[model samples]
Target: MSPYHHGDLRRAILTAALDVIATDGPSALSLRDLARRAGVSHAAPAHHFRDRTGLLTAIAAEGHGLLAEELAGTTDLRDAGARYVRFARQHPAHFQVMFTPNLLHTDDLELTTARALSGAALTDALAPTAPTGDDPHARYARLAVWSLAHGFATLLLGHNLDRLLGDEDPEEVLRELPMFLLPPA
Candidate 1:
């Protein structure tokens, strides 16, 4: 860590990269371009991120942290699935790159930590509310919640919701997923 400048260049570069990747696609990102945009020397980013992969990985990690925070804020585990979709909608930049493994280098420490915490938060968030059942039943129930939220977000992002809903609100569909998936009363 050079103290003269770039004291925290790693974070700066990641922020800049996420912005660029969000506005344009990942293919449009590059160290030189990021440095130029960040007003640092072209070599500055390398000192922190090494390459595009490192920067992308950092962004993904950051995304997971944000998701964890969002999930942590939910008071009702039963409603968290809908909140997950809302999180993705609000943080489209982070949300877009987070699920794409090809876009990130998984070996990065920050990325790994971020992913782990998100998983932990999910388990914590659901533990109290998960239906009482046998092992397979519990696993399937958890998967159903995760998948429904994930699928709804993917559809909303793909604009499929628009084609399906016309002018009506599709968010309601997201909110109702848990009710539909939970074992019938």
Candidate 2:
């Protein structure tokens, strides 16, 4: 591959990797292929990312950071849930890599910090409506909220919701789902 001399090589490689992942799944990603796509030498990606695991870790961290941004400043759990769904739909490649722990270096500091930020954002969103207590019930409530949003996003991304949501807006469905699934507090 021709060496890429200008612009941000790291960002270019990451963008190329995301495009590959978006079209062919993460399993299809490779430094050589990304380098070719970025018009850089095969060693370029390795120089910036070290290896495939490192690349995936970077993607995961970036995804969490993006998710945190999307979930930020939202006090309503339903709104946060809808934002989560929108983020998944908008960045399916990052979403896919972020959730697949096997593809990441789970202990990477950046990944851990980004994940913590996103987790905190989600927890904060649920704090307003969640039962006030440092008890198992409160923790379960948080888990349930996360599960509902995550499950819905997963189903939507997998296209499994098409049959159930046919011609209906998924975000609208999500906004109304908790009303039927959870008991009023």
Best lDDT among the predictions, by candidate number:
2
Per-residue lDDT of 121 in model 1: 75
Clashing pairs in 2: none
Across 32-134, the per-residue lDDT of candidate 2 in tens digits comes to: 8888878888787887898999999999999999999999998587788889999999999999999999999999999999999998998788787777668
Q: Can you write out model 1's per-residue Cα lDDT over 31-65, one digit (the tens) per residue?
A: 99878767778888877776887777777888899
Clashes of each: 0, 0
Candidate 2: misplaced stretches above 4 Å? 1-4, 178-185
RMSD of 2: 2.0
Best by TM-score: 2
lDDT of each: 0.74, 0.87
Clashing pairs in 1: none
